[model samples]
Target: MLPTTRGDFWAEITQIGMDRLWMQRFHVSLPQVSTVASRPGRRSIGFLTECNSSPLQHCGLNVLSGDIIVNKFDLAHHRSGADYHLGTMSLPTDELDTAVEVIIGRELLKSPDQRIVHPHPALMSRLLKLHKAVGQLARDTPDILERPEVARALENELVHVMVRCLAEGASADTTTGVRRHDAIMARFEEFLEANPDRPLYLTEICAAIGAAERTLRASCEEHLGMGPIRYLTLRRMHLVRRTLLHSDPSKVTVTQVVTDHGFWELGRFSVAYRMLFGESPSCTLRRPAEQPNIHLSRPSSLTTAEPRAT
Candidate 1:
């Protein structure tokens, strides 16, 4: 059970004998004046939007202020105002949301792990427009919670519409070969997992994946919500934190562990590690032994400059 500032929201663990999947729900209530903080995670099919008519900050990297709704395929980091609810279908990592109703609505009628790679600008525009429309409908539809069936129907309809829009406008990018995008991502993931303790350069990852730097970067941006190096660095940090808490500190020096995970620059690694985990690597090592668990804290506000909304 992680203790979020809002309260103690228990992380749920669903275990089928030995197989297990962890999930959690977070409901944050902030004073109207406070700025929402940015959080990170893996790509998920989930819904996150303002409730009770609040402005959305940093929508799509363009700071859009309005009641904006988002059904994101890739990972996102943002702040929000007003009370928000989240649900997770699988893991309860900081990267997952607890808005299961919204995720199921979108993913039920679509392919598994639906991802957009090399999305055409036209298609991206239409999808955003559809999202806006659905969000409006949701806001206007009153007493949705009063009738569960009606609420479910409406959510399902919105998902269907969004999926149709994506299918209609999506086109293959001839330059990158859209079909091979997933393969590249798989290779990248494998590489990251195998070398989680080593510092990795974007060029090195591109070489390992056998793709040009531009191509690799484009796909990473489209599918992972960040460039390859950023994603890998975060992943490495996550692993290192986990190891520090669960393994014997005497066996692994902090420098060796972090550098082995592909983080060559000591200063940068220390700063990022401290920023993400909410403590220095040395501090984590000195703490008394505890259960194996890791929670990557949201970065400080200064590191995230608000993007201009398009």
Candidate 2:
């Protein structure tokens, strides 16, 4: 397994082969734990077994001192300036959303906006029961986790319980409270998700979101760290990547996929795709057909310790 640590923060993590689940045990005695970078399509469910500090801030949201920590996949950091211990598992987007909808209700998953849930007393009580059960299983029946059926069953239980606890704890106001920038971003994301095949410019986005050009630009830069146009470009590029990854190269070409996604300028498109995904568009297109053992590497912009799965 890869070791990730700095100062008082350290963790040993393992990925379950090609599956999206990751198990990690991390310990820290500092005021704050460093933000660990991760890809965008997952969520982290952590158990805070030990903590003697104030509320924790994760991804700019507050995580109350509790038995569970649940947040969407993003750069994570502990706001506390004191010591704490954490046990965490990562689940992919679809798994998380489905579990949440089934356990709590579909209302929570309908909003694509990221949220931090402070588990209520009732939820925490239920989590404690799950934590004991899973902890014992991890320790004494390790082989059971290796079984796909067993692991999936446990994972489903964990995801459902976590979401149920979190949603119950959250107040209606808290769940519906969208900050100014977050609201703007949500509107933009909704627009893009609905119109993935539609081409749009900055002025068009501003009008759709009902924000002025300057306001939209500032909000995107502040929340997403990019202007609206750049953000749209990157989103479109990701859509292209997804299409290429899943398409049959025998019947489809990289150029055709890009054109279908409204990427008119092929030259610049190739460069941007490479920079974002660390591979050329053609490599991605060929990947499905070739079925190479090595997949395209992740972008270098993400920082993390060595990812070792035992």
- lDDT of candidate 2 over 218-260, digit per residue (tens): 6665544457787677667757877887898999898889988
Candidate 1 achieves a global lDDT of 0.43
Candidate 1 residues lying further than 4 Å off, grouped into runs, are 1-180, 289-310
Per-model RMSD to reference: 12.7, 11.3
Query: Please, what is the TM-score per model?
Result: 0.44, 0.47
Per-prediction backbone clash count: 19, 6
- Candidate 2, after superposition: displacement of residue 161 in Å? 12
Candidate 2, residue 153: Cα displacement in angstroms equals 16
Per-residue accuracy of model 1 over 212-276 as CA lDDT, tens digit each: 89987776665445677776665566567666766677787888777766677889888876665
